[model samples]
Target chain A: MPLDTSTYALAHLRLDGRRWNELRRLHAQISTQAAADGSSYLEQGNTKVLCTVSGPQEQKGGRGGARDQGNEAKVDVEMNIAAFSGMDRKRRARSDKRVQEMQVTIASAFQSTLFTHLFPHSTITVTLHILSQDGSLLAACLNAATLALIDAGIPMSDYISSVTVASAPSSDQSLDEMDPLLDLNGLEEQELPFMTVGTCGRGPGGGEEKVMVLVMETKVQMARLEAMLSVGIDGCKQVRGILDGVVRSHGKRVLESKVS
Target chain B: MAPYTGIPLSPAELSYLHTSLSQHPPIRPDARSPTAFRPLIAETDILPAANGSARICFADGTEAIVGVKAEVEKTPSASSHSINSHSINGEVADEGVRGLGSGGVRDVEDDGMDVDGGEDGKQSSKGRDEWLEVAIDIPGMRDDDALPVFLSAMLTEALLADGALKDKLYINTRFHWRLYIDILLLSLPLSYPLPLLSLTTHLALLATRLPALVSEKDEDPLFNDDWEASTHLYPPTKDETARQKPPITLLVMSVGENILFDPSREELAVADAVVAISVTQSHTNTTGPDADADADADSPNPLHLIALRTIDPPSRLTAAGLPNSLNTSAGAGAGAASQSLSSVEVAVTREKDQGVSVWRPPRGGVKRAVLARMIKMVVQAGGVGEEVLGGLRGVEI
Candidate 1:
């Protein structure tokens, strides 16, 4: 119904009137839920997610599954999609295969990023609720979980900022003609190939990004994949800047209030 | 105080707590007065995705968040046919007769100020009970657990008690609004959490706004895109004094002769009885001939009681040791004298010196007079309800 990839040649504008390499609006707030050790609500355009982090506290019961190693703390990720999150009202089962796979991916990504050895025999649970979905659901959840863990005072190697990058369908089979879109929405996601990229690092444009998560579910030409990866990495850096700004401003406000 | 995780109080410490509580002016563990609530930090309109949202945190690390979202739904055609009536004058007459007897508070609950006119108002608002859907999420509890289920029911009842909220949801004869209230308890609660949850819900509801509708009459409703054009779901009164506010539930506990509001877990563990009292503002003073002239006076706003529910205090596991009052001995004379004679001697002497002894279980139920007194302390003029209402009035929404 709206503009699609074929229209990119007309004015070089993708859907929603954004050119390639332009990201959607990003907004985030931490410590929104005081009951949890750390919590955050993040919005990337129309996609919204709420995340809460609990523990590093001692694990209860004897069921130490594969996720919970004896020598290091365990990271558990749970995802819940509201029935009204999408345009249609469909209830997701608790054992949905796709959801379970995403949960594992998120858990493993954070397992390495956090210093789990510091809290042996404990568990850190990150629960995420998707309030709305447009596209880039995993990226929004990852970013929100990162902020919540930071608010929970967990030690992490670096901030893990994430975003999605899509490769625009080309008119011809030439490398020069292929364009990489920085962000994808629900409509574009259905018609284009996209990959979510996450990077952990300090400082802006530091030139070294330790990519922690890279997941691509759709098929794309080998020639187009490299450009999408690079664009995705660049988008991650920008997301890191925004996340850092939110943390700094929030910390300043907290400090000022405590001091006064 | 470490509560619910096996209270760590020994017999001596238990006795000391009992003695301190039985004093004429009970000294709470946190040094708050019997009526003073613990200080809390709260914020409203934080969640951008939801129509209205609020978060509240107590000093003891308990926190709760509430979000209210509204969606337009088509009214069920079956109910309209069943309750349809042509006697518009009859309903109007009944409403007027009731409005004159009570004040503004009842007026809101009874018929929602009767602003929508008599024709299809009752028809459109018929099946309003199912309009509000409440879903509560607490970290370690299932949705069907007693606490969550009870909480969901209580919150739904308090909001729908006066039917004012249902009146607001009426869009037209063919359509209405349904609210989805989602509450998340961030941390495990130590005391009864009804008050914390209810207060946060009230703030969230207060901040909720519905998009202004552009389409007129029974056609499909079209909302104005501009968010600034939206109107508040619970608008403040024209005079800025009183409004159609949601009822707020508060927890009150009695220990011995003392009545406490917002009791901490420690106080609740030893409470003789606990009750949740819900109240709303009654604009009784706003009426009468001298209403304008008396508006400037320093009279406190009156509150009307909506509901009073008794909650079981957390198990008295640690408080059932020895009696604090010297006159009452918990055990039989032989048992008190035989094996523990020396310890009993020491306890008796210590009780004489410090007016402290052993903790004894609350023998029976709370007196009718005490329950009445607790109600009076909460609902009376310049009472606990007024204080809470006054405090919330200053919060920016």
Candidate 2:
């Protein structure tokens, strides 16, 4: 059945008012647990993520194959979306496509930056559990994952931050109606085609600039690729800045707690 | 190594293999020696909320955090008699004496004991003996099975052997104190050597500091003196003073025949065997036959000598003789080979009195020789000294 355009438009406007380019207010707390090797809880707008890291220990059997370089380590990434995390309830599946994709993306991002070869034949597993999802769930997960990694004291080339961009057909009929919006929420995502990008470090041009570590796009026109990419990259850079600030403040607080 | 025929190879893989095999002596592009360790960065007391905390980062991006919390509780009645009665008095003596008086006290005291000591009569019956529990959380790696429990057990053993906790101080006390050390590990790049990283966690505890406190109840029962003001307060005897600092543990991982100190996640990936060494300083009496002659002369600083030694090895695939088989064909023979290799032994040596050592594992053959040389080069590049090296040898893996 064809969807009602009018209702969708209203939802889109409401989401837009929430701000496409502006990130949701972020709150991060470090060292949330005593037993974990490292742990952090991150909330991005309505999206909440709790991340924990454990083990540079010997890699488990089956996971450590013969071809694995004796001196090369491996990373295992796991993402769990609670049954109540989404607006629509989700049933748990051990190997769902979406969950698997997230796992791969997270593993790739950490792999590129982490010095895995230092620990030979060992495995570092990062688990990200989403308690709630409003929109930009992946971006929020990445941010939480990085914080947890830092808390764990894992070495990294740099911190990775993510942002989502949506391209809506412009109302003006003359040109192809496609304008890039930043930091899309669930409502905005449902109305327009959008893409999410995760990037490292800060960017230039008053925001932050860095290459995209992972990119995922929903439906979108090929003609607007360049513009959408630009906006998405910019949004990522901005997100990185926010994440950087959060990490710095978190580290300071952790240190201060120890002294006090 | 033969390429698998079943799977199609990407251009990147083809080139990686070609270049890797073509290079003389077959060195990785990163130029790290076989046993070379990546950089290590450690921050102690990283978590302020924790009683004691530490975070260690390996160059390869593997990180682990450890927090120690101390809580007070009554010791088990069955074990109360085993506690050293000399250290505690008054209320403590009453509790210990009452618990030791009858087995009926076991029912009362058992409820107060922690869950871990429920089974052991010796451990559970004690009223004055304190217990330390170490919990390890590996974020995403925790399984419904035994992984979490295993990690906790490994850490607990390490902490006990760490020589940091003042077990003697808590003995015979009315309230038996238990120090809970919780470790949270995150990220852990896949390339890290699991055994080495676990060993690092063990070693990091060596630097953990415990407050120095001695009871003044013997000299000033009312606690009226400004503690330090009481001259009658007994100083920690030589033996007690020697136990003040925790023993330091150092971790060294070997790739093939080479040994590296404090291997990072990346460096651990290529290591063949990892060893942790823990060192402690003990005072030996100078009353031997030769001591009589030396006693007449001015003694040199009492010779508070430090000794280096090896701790228990951690459980790892490599340590278990199961070589990493990512590139190998799957079969029964491969499993057997892995089991055999798990027993491979690495060599270690103490280099100085500063509690460090230089380790040189036996080269299995010519192929391993290359790896050994590479590790040596990496250690040299890092400028690790005898103290650091020997310390690594003493850590409990």
Candidate 3:
């Protein structure tokens, strides 16, 4: 049951004490893994992810020599979901259909963002280790990967920030009480039909924003989808604010340390 | 992980461990007895998303998590295979599904349970037969790797081969409970590899709860609104006839003159032979006629060894049998990987027919006495299964 609070809009639901529109308390750090060129550790609620970026160096041994893109650097993403990261002790094969799909999705999402053409013939490898999973696995991975890339000083058009929003009516109440909950956690995610939205080119009324990735695994009504998309977009922009602040402050700290 | 052929050892290191293990009482790195189990810490019913979930951690830093999700899929229309293809593929009438036009993943992937093979071949010819799917994920290993394929097939067989699990899953012929049991491997065991996977999955299965079937409407299994009303897979064993005990796997290693119950990476390196035996509380389990005698005997444990897999000598999980050279990066990278995974899945399904197929055979044959002792130790370990069953009572799900 949703406890009646100052924000009554979240009343009908929210088992985790988060408001309908509120994001999970996010704790992010850059350069978390010392070995990687750029690395980041991000936590959104209970979902914890570590991302490391290596290369833009020479291409490794090639098995598929036929379709190598001479211009854009190949972006290889390997996502590891730790067995102890979840409530279950489940180990997945690396070539799991979902894992492969995630790899493809993340690689393509960052492909357009990175100036791949700048480092032709070289490969940029992004590896994400999911240490804990609460909910919003894809969104958290996307967000953490973005920060890691930025930390590596990889060129990109804009900072990609992502969030997942779900229509939580069936799980909490009837469909008539359709409420689009932002940044859903593990439990809510199972009950609701959710979509992950990634946005870039975000600023305070500076210019129109761009939608980089909008993935909806479950079906949602067309009319309600519009509403969910708007809410998800707003969630992404808000996340961008936190991420941008971290990036700017990180840049300042690095410069100051260099001068010192 | 590729059954880590013992740890990477120089000739000197290998000789050292080989000589040490050969001594009486096994004077090796760990001072524990040959049969002593490493520490195992476990938690169950942790994931709210899964009907049943559990994580098991070993002292050696290796860990695994398992989640069991019970979903109701419409029984594959046994009569309309060709007709269904016409609807999905329009006019592509290829039964092999390989040449099916614009092949989506479902058209290719077995979706886990396709019991059209195995000893119970053609079981899918009638009503819903295949109701179980097991997926094991090892971090960083490619899908088609020999280790993953072998592990997945072995785990799936551990659960489904006996039909005890599937009998419990059958709500009705129209709609059977399909358990998508996903096991994620966190780390590789340094030495011994046996029960790390089996125990985690056993607990996960024990902790699994199936949604209550409110009613069957038009071949669909409608579930109750309250998840608390769900039924546990291993519910307290109030009635002996309906009971289906979780299967436990034991990794048996034979080093020199010794039959080690649990081998470390170093011990495995020097191991002469390895056998993975899956045991479960016995019932009228007539599925595998080659079942151990204890299945029919009266003992403290009604357990029986259901499946025994032999790993031939020193098949290093790291690099020995990897087909890395075959993977060529190209425009259809995802498609290529998907194709390879499907092929590996087919190969995995075929493994059921070859009873005791060796993944990679360890060379030296063990003394008959050593082999006999290993069996005795495994039978004694059945108490651990009962203790685990006791632990399942605490699983809130």
Local accuracy of candidate 1 as per-residue lDDT tens digits, A1-260: 34454678777887788878888999999988766889999999889888989898876555647445688999999887755466544457657898998899899999999999999878999988877789999999999999999999999888899999988756564656788888788888887888999888844555456889999999988888888888888899899989999999999999999999
Candidate 1: the clashing residue pairs are B109-B162, B321-B359, B322-B358, B322-B359
Q: Over the stretch B112-148, how does candidate 1's per-residue lDDT look in tens digits?
A: 1223223323432343667788877776676678999
**What tens digits encode model 3's per-residue C-alpha lDDT throughout B30-104?**
887776677667888756557777877777666667778776665564346435533745333422232211112
What local lDDT score does residue A239 receive in model 1, on the 0 to 100 scale? 92
Give the Cα lDDT of each candidate. Answer: 0.75, 0.51, 0.67
Candidate 3, residue B376: how far the Cα is off, in Å:
1.2
The segments of candidate 2 whose C-alpha lies over 4 angstroms from its true place after superposition are A1-13, A61-70, A173-175, A204-209, B1-397
Rank all candidate structures by their DockQ, best first, as comma-separated numbers: 1, 3, 2
Candidate 3 regions off by >4 Å?
Answer: A1-21, A24-75, A79-138, A144-260, B1-7, B73-129, B187-194, B216-222, B237-244, B283-301, B315-362, B381-397
TM-score of chain B of each: 0.78, 0.45, 0.66
TM-score, structure 3 vs. true? 0.57
B94-128 per-residue lDDT for model 2 (tens digits): 43322322212223111112232223223323333
User: Listing candidates in order, what is each one's chain A TM-score?
Assistant: 0.93, 0.85, 0.90
Q: Proportion of native contacts found in each model?
A: 0.22, 0.00, 0.03
Better of 2 and 3 by TM-score: 3
